[model samples]
Target: MVFRVDMITLMFGLKRYHHLLILLGFIIATVMATEAMIIAAFPGIEEEFGVSSVIIAWILPAVMLVGAVLLLAIGSLGDILGKRRIVLACLIVYGAGVALAGYAPDMPTLLISRTLQGLGLAIAPLAYALVAEETPVEWVATSIGVLAATYGAGSFIGIMSGAFIIEQIGWRACFLVMVPVVLLLIVFAWHIIPDHGIRKKGKIDLIGMMLFAISILSGMIAITWIGLAGISDPLVWICIGVSICSLFLFLRHENQTEDPLLDLGMIHEAPFPEITINAFLVVFSFFILLQVMPYLIASPAGLALSVIYVGILLMPGSLTDMISGPLAGFMVSRKGVVIPFILGALFLLFGCGIYFLFPMTPVLVVCIWMIFSAGMSILLTIDNMIVVASAPPGSTATASAFLHTIQSIGGALGPIVAGAALTLYAPEEAFTVIFLVVLGVSAIILFQSAGIRRHLP
Candidate 1:
C-alpha cells in the first residue's frame, strides 16, 4: 500500500487530521462565495424580475436577517442536539436554496429560495465550534486562520468571476454551479466530520430564541432603512422601538432562565466581552472600507478607474488577506491573542491614518488596503478563537452565534455610515470622514488591547 501526504497540511502544520479542516474550509468558502456571487448577480436578477432596485433590495437584508435571527436558536439547538447533525441539515437546506434560487421564475420564488440559503448561515458558526471541539487548543487560531483565508479566496473569486459569469453565461449559472459543489460537500461532511453524538443536556430555549429573533430582525430592518429613509422615518422608529424592547426582554430572560439560549453568566466573564466588543469594532471599521473602496475607485471624484482595473487593484489586498490569516494564527500561537490583537489594531490604525492623511494614488490605496485587510483578518480570526476558548465546554456554537450577530450589526452599519458620510459631503471629504471614523474605532481597539495585556499573566 502507498500513502499520500497532503501538502496543505504540511504547510499549515496540522498533522494527520487536515481533512476535517479542509472540509470546514470548503463549507465556509461556499457560503462566502454564494453571498458574493448573488450580489454580483443581483443586477441581472433585477432585469429578469422587472422590479425596481428598491423592491429587490430586501433580498440581501432578508438573507442577513434570517442568519442573525436564527443564529442563536440554531447554534443553541446545535449544542443541545449535535453540531454535526445541525450542520448537515443546514447544508441540505442551503443546497436546495441554491438550486431553487438559480431557476426561480418569479420574484417571490427567488426570495423564498434565497431565504432558505440564509438558514444555512449557521454553518459558519458551527464550523468554528467544531474546530474548537476537535482540534488541539494550541492550533485553534491557525486552523481558523486557514478557514478565514479560504473565505478571502471565496470572496475574491465570487466577486471577480461572478460578474463575468453573469455576463457570459447568465445569472442562474452563478447559483446553479454551486448546487453540485454543495452536494459533494454534504456527502463529505456527512461521512467524515464525525457524529459521535456529542451534545449537551438541555431543552431548547424557545422563548429566548423568539425574542432574539425579533430583536435582531427589528434592529436589522431599522439599520437597512435608516440610511435611505433618514432618522425621522416612522417605520424606522417603529423597528427601532421593537428592537430595543425585545432586546431588553431577551437579556432579562437570559439572566433569569434555567434553559437559556446563551449562558449570560459565562459570557459576562472578562475577556469574552472584550473580545466581542473588539470584534464589533474591527468589523465595523473594516466594513466601511469594503463599502467605500469600489466607490472610491469607480467614482469620478476619486480615481475613476475602469472596472477591470478596479479588480486588478483590489486583488492584491484579497491575496494578502488570504496569506495573512495563517500567519496571524502562527503569531497567536507563539505570542498569544493580546499581542496579535494589539499588532492588528496598530496595523488597522496605521492603515486608516495613512489613508486619511495622504493622497489617494493607486499604489498608496492598495498598500493601505493590504495593511487594513491583514489587520481586519487577524482580528476576525482571533475573535473566533477567543470566543471558543472562553465559551463554556459545550456551548462554543452558541457563543459564536452571539459574536457573529453582534458583528453583523457592525457589518450592517458599515454601509449606513459610508452612505451618510458620502452623501452629505464631497468625495474627498467623505473619504476623509470615513477613514477618520475608522481611525477612531481602531484607537478603541488599541486601547482595549493595551488594557487586556496589562491584566494578562
Candidate 2:
C-alpha cells in the first residue's frame, strides 16, 4: 500500500511540471523549424530573386551570423534583466521578421527580415536556462534532453513540411505559416513562464559587446567573401585584417572590463573550454554534411534529386535525431555525460566514415545520413547538458550563449567552406574533401572525449 502510494506521488510530481517542458519544446521546435525550413527552398528563392549563387548562399549564414554575434550580449542581458522579459521581446521581433519575410518583395528585403529573425536565437539558451533553474537537479539532464529531441523534431518538420509547402504553395507561404505559430508560442510563453526569475545585478558592457560583435561579424564575412570572391580579392583581405584587429580589441576589452559581457574568469573554468571547443568541432562536422549533402543530391553528377525528394531522403536523419535526443538525456541521467559524449563521438565518426566508403545512391545515402543524424542528435543533447552543468549557478544562460556563439561560428562557416570547395573542385573531389575534413574533426572530437572522460567526476 505504501509503495503504491509513493509511486502515485512520484508520477504526479513529474506531471506537475510537464507544462513547462511542453512550452520549452514548443519554443525549441519553432526556432529550429523556422531556421531549417528555408534550407530546402534556397534554390527556389534564388530562382525567384535572380540572385547569384554566392548571394543565395549568404542568406542562411547571414541569419546565423547575426544570431552568433548577438547571442552572448543578449544572454548577458537576460542575466542582468529577466529572461522572461527578453523572451517576450525576442518573440515580438521574430513574429515581425516572419511576417516581413513572407511579404518580402526582393532579396534585400528578405535579408533584412532574416536579420530580424536572428534576434530570436537567444531564446534557446534563455529557455534552457529557465528550465535548468526551475527543474530539480535529478531531472535536469532529462529535461534538457527532451528539449533537444524537440529540436530534432522541429528540424524534421521544417525540412519535410517546408519542402512540401514550398512545393505546393510557394516559399512565401512557408514563412507566412510560421507567423501564427510564433504568435501562439508568444501567447503561451507569456502566460505559462514565470514573469520574474533570477536576475544578476550588473550594468551592460557596451564596449565589450561592440568589439565582440565586430570581431565575429568581420571574421565570418571575411570567410564568406573568400569563398565567394577568392582570397586574392582586396575586400577579402581587408575584412580579414579588420577581423583580426577587432578580435584583439575584444579580447583586451574583456580582460580589462569591470563588468564583461562574457566573464573571462568563468570561461577559464575547467571543462567549459573543453565543452565549448567540442561544440565548435561537432557543429562544424555536422553542418558540412547538412549543407553539402543537399548540393550533392541535387547536383547532376550525383543523384540529382528534386528539392522535395531531397527533403524526403533527408527526413530519416531528423527522425533519428528526434528519437535519439531524449535517449541521450536518459543516458546522461544514469551514466553521466562522459559515456554519452564518447558514444556520440564514435557515432559521428562512424557516420562520416559511412559516406566515405559507400556508393552515393538515394537509399544508401539515406541510411548513412540517418546514422549521422543520430550521432548528432546525441552529441547535441549531451553538449547542452555539459554546458549547463559547467555554468555557475544563475549564469546558465550566459554559458549556454557562449557555447552557442562558438557553435554558431561553426554553423556559419560550414556552408561557406563547403560552397567554396564545390566551387573550386569537381563534385566528387569536393565531397571527398568535405568528408575528409569532417572525419578529421571527428577524430579530434574523439580525442577530446577521452580527455573529458579522464576529468569526469
Candidate 3:
C-alpha cells in the first residue's frame, strides 16, 4: 500500500516527463536497432555480393568507427548548435543514408552509405543529455533505465525481424522498410523535444576534433586490420604506431586546449574513468558474444544452425534485457546504483564462467547468453545513470559522448578480435579462449564496481 502511494506520487510529481523519456528512448532505439539490423543481414549480404568474409566484416566496423570518431565532435556541436537541431539533421542524414544503402549497387557504395548513416550515432548521447537536463533528480536514473530498456527492445525487434524480412523480401528491403519509420520518428521528435534549452558559448575545438578523429580512426583500423591480417603485416604495425602517436598527441592537445572536445578535467574525475573503462570492457565482452554467436551456431563445425535459428537463439538475450532494463531502473531508484551495478558484474562473471566450463552447444550457448544479456541490461542502465549523474552540470552531453566514443571503439574491436581468435585457433578452442578472456575481464569489472559505490548518489 505504501509502495503504491509512493509510486503514484512519483508518477504525478513529474509533469509530462514520461512523454519526453519515451520519445528520446524511441530515437535512441531506432539508431541502435539499425546496427543490429545490419548485423542480422550480414550473411545474406555476403551471399549476394559474393564477398569474402573478411570484406563483409568491414561493413559494420566501418559504421562503428566513423560514428566513434565523430561522436564527441557532434556532441560538442549539439552544445553549440542546439541538441534538437543537430538531432533532427542527423535523422535526415540517417534516413537518407539508409535509403541509399538499400539501393547500393556495389560493396563500396553500401559501405559509404553505412558510414553516412553513422553520422546519427550522436543521437544517443544527445538524447541522454536531454533527458538528464529535463528530468527531476529523483527520476533521472529511472528515466535513463527506461531509455536503455527501449534500446534493448529496439535491438531485439530489429535483429529478429531483420532475419525474417531478409528471408521474405531480401536484405536490401530491410533497410528500405525502416525509412518510413524513421521519418515518423523525425516528425514526432520535432514536436516533443524542446528546440531551445542549453547552449555553450565557444567555437568548436576543430584542432582537437581533427586530432581525436585521426587517433580513433587509426586505432580502430589497426585493431581491425590486425584481426583480418596477421600481426606480421607491416601495415598493421605502421597503423599501430600511428595510432599510438596520434593518441598521445591528441591527449596532450586536449590537455592544453581551452575548449577541448572531451573536457579532460571531467574525465579525470572519480567514477568517470571507472565508468568509461568499464563501459569499454563490458561492450568489448558483449560484442565478442554478439559477433561470434551467429558464426558459432551457423558454422558447420559447430551447430550448423540456419540464419533464422541463429536469430532465434539470440532473441532471448534481447528480450531478457528488455525486461531487465526497467527492473534495473526500479532497483536503482529504490536501492541506489551500487547493488544493481554489482549484481550486473556478477551476472556477467557467472555467464562467461559457464561458457568457459561447458562445451559449445546451441542450447547451452543460448541459456548462458540469456544470463549475459540480463547482466548487460543492468550494466547498461546503471552505467548511463552513473555517467549522467557524475558528469559536471552542463556537460552531460559531452560526458555521455565521451563514454559512447569509448563504447563505439570497443564495438569496432569486438568482431575483429573475435574474428582473429577464430582464425588463430580451431572454432571450439577459439570460443573457449574468447570466453575465458571475457571471464577475466568481467572479474576486473566486478572489482571496479566496488570502487564506484562511494561515488554514487
Candidate that scores best on TM-score? 2
Give me the overall lDDT of model 3.
0.79
Q: Is candidate 1 or candidate 3 better by TM-score?
A: 3
RMSD of each: 4.2, 4.1, 4.6
> On a 0 to 100 scale, what is the lDDT of residue 112 in model 1?
89
**Top candidate when judged by lDDT against the true structure:** 2
Model 2 vs. true fold: TM:
0.93
List runs of model 3 lying over 4 Å from the truth: 1-15, 454-457
The lDDT values for all models are: 0.76, 0.81, 0.79
**Alpha carbon deviation, residue 231, candidate 3 (Å):** 0.8
After superposition of all CA atoms, the RMSD between model 1 and the true structure is 4.2
Name model 1 segments beyond 4 Å from true.
Answer: 1-16, 38-61, 103-113, 170-172, 300-302, 419-433, 454-457
How does each model score on TM-score?
0.86, 0.93, 0.92
Please give the lDDT score at residue 42 for candidate 3.
64
Which residue pairs clash in candidate 2?
A: none
Writing each residue's lDDT as its tens digit, candidate 1 over 175-228 gives 899899999988888765766435788887889889988887686667556655
